[model samples]
Target: MRRLRCPYCGAVFEVPKGAVYAVCPYCGTTVVAKTGEEATRQYYYPPRLDDGEAFLLAVSRARMLPGAPADIAETASLARSELHYLPLYICSAEAWVEGCEGAREEREETWLATSRLPLPGLEHGYRFPVVGREPYDPRRARRGVFHQPDASPEPRCSALRARVEYRAAGEARLAGCRGSVESRAGLVGVAHYPVWLIEYHHPLAGQPLRAVVDAVDANLLYLEYPIPLERRALVLGGAALVLGTGLAAAAAVGLAAGSLAASILGGLVGSAVAASPLLATGLSRTGRYRYRPPRVERLFIKG
Candidate 1:
């Protein structure tokens, strides 16, 4: 085993022979065992939420769901709450195409979260505002689980380099010249982002529903909430009313026009149109619980 000290926290840990990376158990910093200059440093974002605050936010988000019980915020029981630090790799690359006349330069950046766990709503295009990032510290984690990076950052950095080179080549082509690319990956860093996994239960939902929130920004990422009986009844009643009214209107028109065919066609059209919305609603809220965010937006740290 090779022993390596974490650059950010100075915690010494051992990695298997020929291993590339290992996360420091003390500070949760992913340290590279080799490739000194090419390796990226690791940092973490401090969590802005506490246990009580995270649970309250989850309850509030649940109450905001469509057809949610009015008393859910008051009556829901907090079952479990867990804090986790997920790893995200930030890779940047810049390329310059050397042409006969001039050179064209292009840059590319990408953020990739490399957790194999079943975390929902954590995908590419989710931007992390590069602010308030400090050196990884276990004390600041507040007893949260520091999930190790499941994948390496090299592939992502390579992809970024390819993108930069492609863009540079395109620019050279537009300038009426073919060129060769000179590209290098830059600023390869891993950031451990804080997340809250909250579970709550209400009598209406039978089972506990989970909510994932960004601890730094308090933005709800994923949510599962119970559907209120009142809303379900209202939807059913409205559908019935619309169906009956349309059938009556169709029958009246048929009687006025003295044509059964027109009545049948009108009724069919009316039924299809009226049922479409209701069917969609029902399908979306198929079970007692629904998984969706009320007002979703990009979650990032305050600059």
Candidate 2:
């Protein structure tokens, strides 16, 4: 076992070099990962909520939102809540993106423009203001039985850095220049964010509600629940009204312009657009529980 020193109590202890974070045995303080380059340390807050508490926490917060169904907390059934810890490498880096202006016009020459953009989905690319390699707050030691985080049997970190860099470059490229961008990490550390996948059956409509909650702060990152039948009707009706109005206007304009084919085509296209939304809404309401995906970004929280 390799020996690592605890910055909090100044105690030297044995730990695996590959271990990113560990609780200091001497002081009971959480020790965050340190790059081999630095003498200083950092911190990460693990899931204070335990497996047994997972379902309870989710239930308690289910209907807490301002517009939540009144019976969501009281009558909604908590079908299941599973624990997952998603891996992320949080880093502070120096990145410079260099891409020639797609078409830059000088004072007397061509054209130039640039812009900035991007981030990722709910479950994945969770951009928290979270930091790494910091000291653990001793006062944060709360009582709970934390389960071992589920680890993928396959390798994952192999391409993590590359993926991060690729995203960084893509951001620059999207801003309007087509060129190469490179990033060098000054400090990089891994942390697993705690998440809970909770399944619920809403009481009002008895529709299924799927939710993903951030176990760390109990943030409801994503939720898909039934829209009440009344609300569904409103959506369908409003969509139809809007589509009819738009098509009527288009058809009138085409007729005034003496184009029968244009008017007919516009009406047909409008009819299809009007049908699509209602079809989706109808399909969702077909079963006892509405068809819905639990999370916005399927790859984010689970992975």
Residue 46, candidate 1: C-alpha displacement in angstroms:
1.8
**lDDT at 63 for candidate 2?**
48
Model 1 lowest lDDT segment of ten: 284-293
TM-score (C-alpha, index-matched) for candidate 2: 0.45
Question: What are the per-residue Cα lDDT tens digits for candidate 2 across 1-303?
Answer: 467666667777665555555445544443553432222333445765664465555556544432344455566667766655443334443444565433221111100000111111252334443632234354653332222212221133324445555555555555666656554443344333456666766655554556666567655556555555665666567667767777777788888989967886877687768677564654454222222334655453211
lDDT of 2 at 229: 66
What lDDT is obtained when candidate 1 is compared to the true structure? 0.68
lDDT of 1 by residue, 1-303 (tens): 777777667767676665555667666757665742213566778889876788888777766554566677898888998888777766677788765345455554535455465466564345565677786555565666766555666777788788777767766776777657788886557778888888887787767888777789887777776666667666666667777788888888888889967896889687769766654444444223223434579774322
Error of 2 at 101 (Å): 24
Cα TM-score per model: 0.65, 0.45
List lDDT for all candidates, in order: 0.68, 0.48
Best model number under lDDT: 1
